[model samples]
Target: MKKTKLLLISLLLTDFVMLLQPENAWAGDVQITCDLRVLELTSQQRNQIRLRRQQYKTRQRQMNENLMNQNVTDRQLSLRHFFSKSAFDNQQADEIAKQRYANDVRQTVAELNFYHDIFQLLDNRQREIWLQQCVQPAGRI
Candidate 1:
């Protein structure tokens, strides 16, 4: 008898909970899913992409070398501290560093553009996968 009563109560509770949920609760959700698979590429096409990737890698190495090659020419401390003195003599050094920085920036932009161009070759599903992994996008389409 006790078990029968417990079963009856459990059935009633489930019925009451089901009644509390309104209709159309699951209709508002949107899901877009796609498979990501690399398609076949000809040998020539593959070689072209490999060449571009190598070029970007070389530019990255050069930028890193520029930063590593900077010489810290300041040693003595005087009344002419970090900002008080005119940077007249060391102008060449400053210019070199500035040019290196500009080169680095240009190379970075070029690398990103290369990647963007390559991404355009992806299929819709592959593009979605690429976008999901990207943090800062190259820019909007």
Candidate 2:
């Protein structure tokens, strides 16, 4: 009786642990499919973008994990709450404002660099067609 009860408890614990695993734990194949669909690239273009996209995805995943870890940190959570409350004095407010401006500038620079590379890859005609296809209303197509 004792051995049977121990086995049942162990099985239940194993099942519970499996349930707690992330949904994306088995997402490798699905991610590839999603990337293909979202990028809508030819095979050559896919090959060119694959490494960069993989790196970006890896960085994004790490950032998300870092955010999750931060959420579990009491000090970090308190700081976030404080910021949300807008309780900063003028000096702190100015520092926050400057940091936000710098972040925006960095993001814009990165976007422009990406566009520059993409533009280099496409000729003018291809660029015009791509812009029309992407930007035009669906019904007009």
User: What is the number of residue pairs that collide in model 1?
Assistant: 0
Candidate 2 ranges with C-alpha deviation above 4 Å: 1-42, 67-88, 97-116, 135-141
Candidate 2 displacement at residue 68 in angstroms: 4.2
Q: Quote the positional error of residue 69 for candidate 1 in Å.
A: 1.8
List, residue by residue over 5-106, the lDDT tens digit for candidate 2.
999999999988876554323321111112233335567766666665566557556655654565346655555765787566677566656743564354
TM-score of each: 0.38, 0.39
lDDT (Cα, tens digit) per residue for candidate 1, span 32-98: 1222223344565567667877887887888778666755444223223634656644765575457
Report, for every candidate in turn, its global Cα lDDT versus the true structure.
Answer: 0.56, 0.53
